[model samples]
Target: MDFNKKVIALLAVALLATGSWSCKKIIDEAPLDKLDITNAYRNVADADAAVIGIYGQFLGLQKTYILQNELRADLVDVTANADPYLKQLANHTTTKDNPYVDPRPYYQVVLNCNDALKNFKLMVDDRRMSVDDYNKHYSDIGALRSWIYLQLGIQYGSIPYITEPVEKVDDIKNLSAYPRISFEELLTRLIDFTEKLPYKEVYAYPAGNPLVVTIDGSSTNKLFICKPFVLGDLYLWNNNYTKAAENYEKIMDVENNNTNINISFNAYKVGYYLSSDYTDQSVRYLRAQDESTLLVDAGWRTIFSAPNTSNVWNIEFLWGIPYNANYKPGNPMIEVCSSLYGKYLIKPSQLAIDNWNAQRQYSGIPYDARGKLSYSTTVAGPVITKLTDNIVPATNFNRAGKWGIYRAALLHLRFSEAANRDGKGKLGWALLNTGIANTFYVGTYVNGAKSPVSFDEINTMQTPYAAPYYFDARSNNDYKSPWYRNTGIRSRAGITALDISLQNNVLGLEGKLIDEGALELAFEGNRWPDLLRIARRQNNPAFLAERVYQKLLKDGDPNASAAREKLMTPANWYLPFDWK
Candidate 1:
């Protein structure tokens, strides 16, 4: 053979082999997907996979522009931006041309949920899954569907409860073949389906030490947050607050029974409070509420770092979801670090300092029954920039090279100082009720530094958060002079520990939180469709006003004259609504 010809021939052979190898790799990398229902619905594992398909609905449930995030469009302060999504929602009589304002995005959640349900229903048989678990999973899917529809109704005011999968293109040839369901009727069905569904119990216990049974009553509390009957069960949307409170109270009772989210009630403790006790750990009341729900594990992380927190029951929750995220949009403390004070170590906001001084009252001082502060801050300034100080910081997990924020603690989870006192003054101020202090110290790791920070320069921010320290003329009625502290740790440690605060707040972010649209659940993926359903945006003027005013007080109050002047108007809530 000619030398040139042999070279060309060898190259061709090598190319063919490489191409073949690539093809094999793609096939191997694909999910163990068996889309054909007819061929595979005969065994337990097959059933598991089929059910897994339904789980996809939940995949984006917490992700953006889907059900949860979409749902935030309705409430006052759920989304970061709410308008553009509203534009897409085609409210016929309204000027908006898009069907869902945030139309296409929400439908993705709905469509996927419908597809999962329809496909699973069609292929369901005795062969593909374990009969018992299969039914449970099936019901779980139904529960999820009911929630999706409920969100749809809330967003669009009407929706077609699509039951069957669009098996073929011909099914839509006649336009009238598929009709829309009214919001009222869909709402009823949501309740109907949710009624019979059993809670899908999935217990997640810490490794090795299995004796605790789930910290929230084992698997018994694994209930749905958005079941059909949830409307009647907890009441929702406009006029739902009262019943919602009752439902939350009911949940508290149940959780208490399981000893999952019990507040520390032991009478024998001395604190600044004459008779007070509370746990710092909190929960969101979503799914799988348990005793350990508030105990944020060093590993399990969530959207909130525990600062952007609130109660579905107004203020009954143990913790609220803060918007702090480590590598994403924004992290409360870490992001704050990038601010003038956090970045330059000019000192945390004066607001945060005030808040810290107020909270410190309970640690070493006292409070009276009439909601009066009975003591003062013995130690002020930079009360606690890190959560590790609140709990026994974990000492177990060490450096394999990865930076460790928290190790592990033998202490039960706690949120604010109140977590330890529980309505009786064990720590300091007597428990008038389960109250959380608004003040905390914000010290600096390095005094007045810029860009790179030293370990001792970390600081905190608090302005009007503190309780008045006496009749000092400098203090407002609800204000306290903020204190500062110099800490040995870095801001990273404080921020990382905050992540644990949110993830473990099953008590506040209880596993049973129902109807949490993406607004409050923004980015968390629980609200999109619901936001669309309500025709509201997460950061709508009204919403942002509330968030800035209440939910994100730490971020700053939107009601401030400066905030109003700078960011007033619902338009700020608008987004691109790019479901296209």
Candidate 2:
């Protein structure tokens, strides 16, 4: 399958790859002495370096990073089963993993950004670099820093916004306050930085920015204003829906959006399933018939014989960045790319299938039991490889080729928190309250003949569904529970398991972070962030209100399940941040 192509692009950096003198100390030598974000600059490959340093913050990513760490729902461990991990994560069973503490990481990224900002200021102030170098790098780093802060503010509520470089030599104590700005203030700052950024041209400006300009005029265009989606997402998160749409639109709109990639869609969707030797004429067909057209990004990537969609911005995704744990590049924006907030449970969720079934019956759409697709050559197509590294002869690209980026949105993330929780929730229907008969039967019967059966011709008269009995539960129960007779669930025919109050801790609350109306970001892995940022990940006493009603001791609610026996409490929210 194309799955091999998924993890191919990410490479670990070597000491030598970090060529700069100062940076070499960081890469080749040892990790920084202080491991602090304070002493850095934006030069000497500094922006890349600082970004990488921030990557350190993500080291403890998979641990108790999320609040209410519940894995029993989808039933997967938080560590493995990558796809399942994501599916369960969306279920609100856990907090967002690997979150950067606000003020700390934001300030860290800000330090890196301020370093670059300072350098850019130096470029403009002293006229050290030429016009081309100045503008290109200026805009490139400008966008980079802007993207960092944008991430900072979005993940953490009200960050201590800092613009200027720190006076590392003088004093860091006289720094900006740790107070946060309003969401509007934060969004505005992001807009300001994003507005000034030059897109699709990561090459530093002037006739010759140092990074891209070779000594002998040869070219080495490492980082540039060229990344496709960086700017698009900036506007997207800012609630500039029109602007966001425009950015994503540019990746496809032919003349307006001159894209360079093949499967001009959010290739990350199905792109993860590509092979290493992805460059082939056959793959071109996949790009030709791209599906990235109708996307939040969209694509017809599987149209031709090509393998799958291309990672073009605006085409598939208006823009997206891979979660570069290093380079501090893996922003929350695409940390899990095609992944969801609900990580896949070691146990898969039947939710998707259930929804599909319900939809099929209601909408008359056909259903495929193999409803979910995974990235395996056996299943994901060119997404994964066979026994060994096998490259088949190139043919026309397969239109069905997918890298797994964009997709249909999720309605609900399955629940997977497997705690032996006993916190019960109580919802009672007393015989006295409804004025029903105080006497309750042993089961779904009135201790007599044919227990109030509600007849349905299909299950009885019709031969196709013929049976001695039909489930006459609901209507039958209506008759039994009524003290007034023939109305309540007293004479029911279906088995009525004992109902009990919901107790124990199983927190369940979810909301959008970047309002879905703004980003239209359907639940992939958003639930974790939602619970974390709002500090709602905790299961406290306040989260649960004890229901103390004087009800008969024996009679209980019938709808209760063992899963609900667990209560929704404050401790269930999440483990403390450093506990992981």
Candidate 3:
């Protein structure tokens, strides 16, 4: 770690931060002296530019995040043409020299965030920045830093939790000062840091705010890291089920009005459902008759390909990083997963294909439409085309693709995971299978007698949960209600509901939730984390190892046994923390 190289990296960040936005003129007009930390944060505009610059540095993480999270999971496998580095990841035999194993890029973002957090506090104390702006920007950066640290711990196992700004490159090499902490300790630190933040809301900029950058006619407001999602995820990993559910419920309750009159615009709800009538493109989808006639409709795929302006797309995606070909950091996923115009480095595993194929649609159809919609069988291999579909024909390049961070399906599935562990297995099962409203309102018979729904259940279903830790899904014959709109994760996928008996078996319900997360979130960079989290929670490393083993066996890999053996040990699950 040369000092000159560190200086060059910081300078590069300054240039990138200044120019990353679509409206480059504002950043370009800033005085060169303002780029320095000493002069930066003197005003609101300067603070905004500094935060935007941090985002520019974050763009470098897109490739590593997906590779580390997906390549090592059960859903994704490397192609024959993939680099040896990628093959090592899939085989769980990563070397120190593997480029993806380098943790400097992750630390770079953390360092930037550390610098910004310190300066923001000073600005607020000096009255240079208002409390409102300080809360919004400070929490945004704090959440971002916590998220990066979490990713580091998840991938590298034990990592040095460095909070102070590293003025010199050599400072990081002194591990004696900042000792590496276990993932459990890291979670405790993050939960404490995130829970105490002044603001927990999304950073929604005003109409004429300079921070609002429009990319290719689509306005980008989802750049900031979601604070509640971060806190929820931290609590989830730490095994605080009730606290996790509470934080997640906060995000889901964003659009809920306190009134009893239920309206339809709940962005947090998984409102998409299958329909034979293809009149409403937003909420309804036509089921494919069979495997051969599986139509890739705009309904499901639009979650990834649709523009940010789309209401349906907005409802699903909570945070996304916009990419443009003309920009410095172009879309990395296109080159990684695309077979048509890109490298075709990796493809979906046979296990993933089988998982999707085994599912029966709501109409009892054999195949899951999401499988075909997510990827396609090509001459080369089964290429994953989820985010890489919108390619520019003129340039033969992917003109745009969003790196999605959080979404409704992932949120709901995670909530269900927490709820099940918190002894709310019935509520968890309903969200995972059918809508909450449908489950409670349509009461089942108990020993020839129709079980009466409780008053609290009925009230919550009809009015919808606003505060505390209750959830509602009953439409009460009014389809416009937000609770009624939630058709559950499986229902949105046009899949049949799981048996009601499984709800009582808490462990079984947890397993089903993980399975549903795979089918829904697959390559969105959540499979590995979801699997790892549950395995750790249950204290069963085999839970994760067996799945990876099965995937390897399905692919006919000779090293499947060895890989499974390695993964059985909790210590071997994380990448080596060898990078200085």
Best by TM-score: 3
Write model 3 residue lDDT over 355-425, tens digit each, in one string: 99999886677767788888889999898988675554425543466778899889999998888888877
List, residue by residue over 423-502, the lDDT tens digit for candidate 1: 21111110111111212222333454322232222222222222211101112233322111111011101111112232
What TM-score would each prediction reach against the true structure?
0.39, 0.41, 0.87
lDDT of 3 at 453: 59
Q: Top model by lDDT, which number?
A: 3
Off by over 4 Å in 2: 1-103, 169-176, 198-240, 254-371, 374-580
Candidate 1 local distance difference test against the native: 0.28
lDDT of 2 by residue, 246-298 (tens): 44333322222225233322121122122322221111212322322211111
Give each model's whole-structure lDDT. Answer: 0.28, 0.29, 0.75
Who is ahead in TM-score, 1 or 2? 2
Which consecutive 10 residues in model 3 have the weakest lDDT in total? Answer: 276-285
TM-score, candidate number 3: 0.87
Q: Pick the winner on TM-score between candidates 2 and 3.
A: 3
Return the number of clashes found in candidate 1. Answer: 166
